[model samples]
Target: MSGSWRAGLLAEGVSITVTAKAYRLLRAILMTATEDDKMLSRNPCWIKGADNERTPERPILTLAQVFELADRMADRRFKAMILLTTFASLRWGEVIALRRKDLDLTARTVRVREQLLELEGGEMRLCPPKSRAGKRTISIPSAIIPALADHLKRFVDEAEDSFVFLGKRGAFLRGGNFRREAKWAEALKEMGLTGLHFHDLRHTGNTLAAQSGASLADLKARMGHDSDRAALIYQHATRDADQKIADALSARVKAERKKARKKDH
Candidate 1:
């Protein structure tokens, strides 16, 4: 069945993503039938690499490009959002779910406890992180502290439970609405970053963290990955080491800003 489906999909010119998802669906259904129902002695939906989707490598912004993208946002509120997501390695769900209490500017930390999940009918619900490792305390660079402080003063409510970021109507941020209102596409295009995704900001942060000499365990803890395949060295990762990574990020930003100033002069 798997072999025929693969051949049929290829012959029909189905996209790789659709073919892989279809293969995954078939594999999952067969696995359930074999293991739970015991209707089949073995699952035959086995095709090597058929379920894997080979997506293109996402673009990573340089430190200077990150700042440029953030500055290009017409809404000042989104400036901090872009920087925080890039520097702190926050997922979209986690960033949108952030409450005033989640950030500690004095301590330079951001805590992730929950995510704002969008349901099928456009309903939004606050739920815990996808995995245990996702609920983590991340050290943020001091360079973005001023932007965050400014955003909170102007945009966020004083109540601790109030969301850190909000829509124009003082409600939870919706992804589509945010993109349209914040001029996300315009900002990207103006910065020559067409097709760059918001999630790529987190990828840039993770890459920077690694380049800062963060160990494998440090990456695991920072990224919130729990599967054995994705996790290692968590026990050895220390808060101090994470702080060093944050400091390195801050230094990089400072250096980049100085270079920009020099060029302007």
Candidate 2:
């Protein structure tokens, strides 16, 4: 069955990561059913290290690059959105679902209560976030407060219940529509950044937080991740911070050796 699945995926040009996930899910379900049915003392669907396969790493943007992209955006309204997602570590749905009341400018915090999901037929529905942890309050940076304030004052509706972000026709913002209408491709070209997805902004924020010495618990809370595994990925993804630590250790060892040599002389 595994060989057949692999052949099918290859024929369809599906990613190996996707194949692994599909097989993992199927294996779990089959093993559980077999165990429950007393078919065997121990159900055997285990393929060593198959469940531990890693996907391709996501691209993370620098703080300067994030700001530059925001600045180059054609729509003034989306500029704040870019900053909020990268700095506040908000998912696309969480950011777009924001209402006027969800934002507390005085406190500089955004309450993530819900998310807006767009169905296949362009229908939008308000739903709870992906996980319980996703329903969190994130504090905004002082630097971005002004941008959010300006956005609210200029573009947002007056009613507290009104959506913070809306389409030109006063409808809920759809991801596809926003990408095309906002000239996302053109903006990326100008920034010389290719293959950067919108969700990568959240990854950038989580990685930056990890690099800043935020503990795993802090990262989990800030990113609204339910598992420590997700938080650990951010720490592992911070290559620059890891290199700095290595450099510091080398410098300290060199300094100690120099001091010992001087004393011996």
Candidate 3:
């Protein structure tokens, strides 16, 4: 049955990723039913590498490129939004959900408490973050503070509970609406980053943090990842730091050899 389904999907030109997910889901359901019926001692849906799907590497922008992209954005609110996501490693939902009360300019911290989830039919719901780690307090860079302050002064409502970022109509900022009305695509095009997604800003920030010698725990906390696997991606991204480690080891060896030679003499 699995083989026939796979063949059918292939013939239908379904993507491997979609086929893999469908098979995985089907396997789980069948296995669970079989277990309940005492038809099998264990799940027999094991397909090698089925669960280890890999997507293409996400594009990451440098700090300069991030600022360039932000500057190119016509909306000043978006400029602050871009900077916060890149520097604070915030997700799109988290950034859009920010309220005046969440930010503390005096302490330069942003408290991530909840997210504004945009459901179908333009309905918005406020919910807790994606994970426990998602509800964290992140320190903003001093450079970002000025822009955030300016944004608050000009764009945000004076009330603490009011949303920090809103559409021109003062409605919740939906991803689709922002992409269309804010000219996000055009900004990317002007920056020569046509295919880059907004989430890549978080990726860039996490990679930069890892390269700056942040520990695994720190990376996990900053990226709001519940698992080590995601944090390890940033560790892998810091190949230049690996080179620096090699150079330091070589320098230590050279220093030890020189000391030994001098003592022998």
Candidate 4:
């Protein structure tokens, strides 16, 4: 039955993602029937890797590229948004949900208490983060503190409950509206960064943090990921970073040898 289902989906030319989701749904139903309902002697949906969705590689922008992208924003308000998103590894939902009180410029931290979720009918709702770890306070990089402060002064209202990022007409910003108003696609084209998603900003930030010799625990805390596996995926060591580690190890070994020789003498 699993083989037939796979064959039928392939014949229909369904996307890999859709196929994987469909297969998982089918497997889940069959598993329930076999175990809970006792309708089947054994489950037939035993396809390996059929339920796994292979995510495409997201582009990791360099620090220079990140700055360049921010500079190209036509709306001055969005400049700080881009910078904060990259440096702080904030998801779109979390960043948009930021309130004036959530940020502490003096302390250089952004407290993520909730996220703004856009519902099916385009209604915006504030809900708790996807995971407990998501409700965290991230330490902001000092380099972007000035930019964040500037954004608050210029765009955000003085009220603590006021949204940190608002639309030009002082309305709540939605994901679809943000893309249209920000001219996100055009900006990417101008920077020669075609096919880059907004989420890639978070990915870039995570990659940068990992490259900074962040321990697994540190990465998990900063990224607000619930699982070690998710944090491990972000630990992409660059060639330069790897070289620095090798050089440091070599120096330590050489110093130890020199000390040993001096003691013998």
Expressed as tens digits, the lDDT of each residue in 1-265 for candidate 2 is 5556554442332344776787788777778777777665664556555554565666789889999988887887889999998999988888889999999989999999999887756688899998999899988888989999999999988999988888777788876667766788899998888867787888788888888888888999999989998898777767666898899999999999999999999
Best by TM-score: 2
Task: State the displacement of the C-alpha of residue 241, model 1, in Å, after optimal TM-score superposition.
Answer: 22
Off by over 4 Å in 1: 1-52, 228-265
Q: Each candidate: what lDDT?
A: 0.82, 0.82, 0.81, 0.85
Which sections of candidate 4 miss by over 4 Å?
A: 1-52, 236-265
Residue by residue across 118-224, what tens digits does model 4's lDDT show?
77666889999989999999999999999998999888889999999988888778765677787877888998887677778888999998888788899998888
Clash list (residue pairs), candidate 3: none
Query: Clashing residue pairs in candidate 2, if any?
Result: none
Worst 10 residues of 2 by lDDT: 7-16
User: How do the residues 1-117 of candidate 3 rate in per-residue lDDT, one tens digit apiece?
Assistant: 566666455333244577788878988887877877767676666666654446557778888998898888877778888889889998878888999999999999988999888
lDDT of 2: 0.82
Candidate 3 lDDT: 0.81
Error of 3 at 84 (Å): 0.4
Report the poorest 10 consecutive residues by lDDT, candidate 1.
229-238
- Each prediction's total of clashing residue pairs, residues at least 3 apart in sequence or on different chains, is 0, 0, 0, 0
Top candidate on lDDT is 4
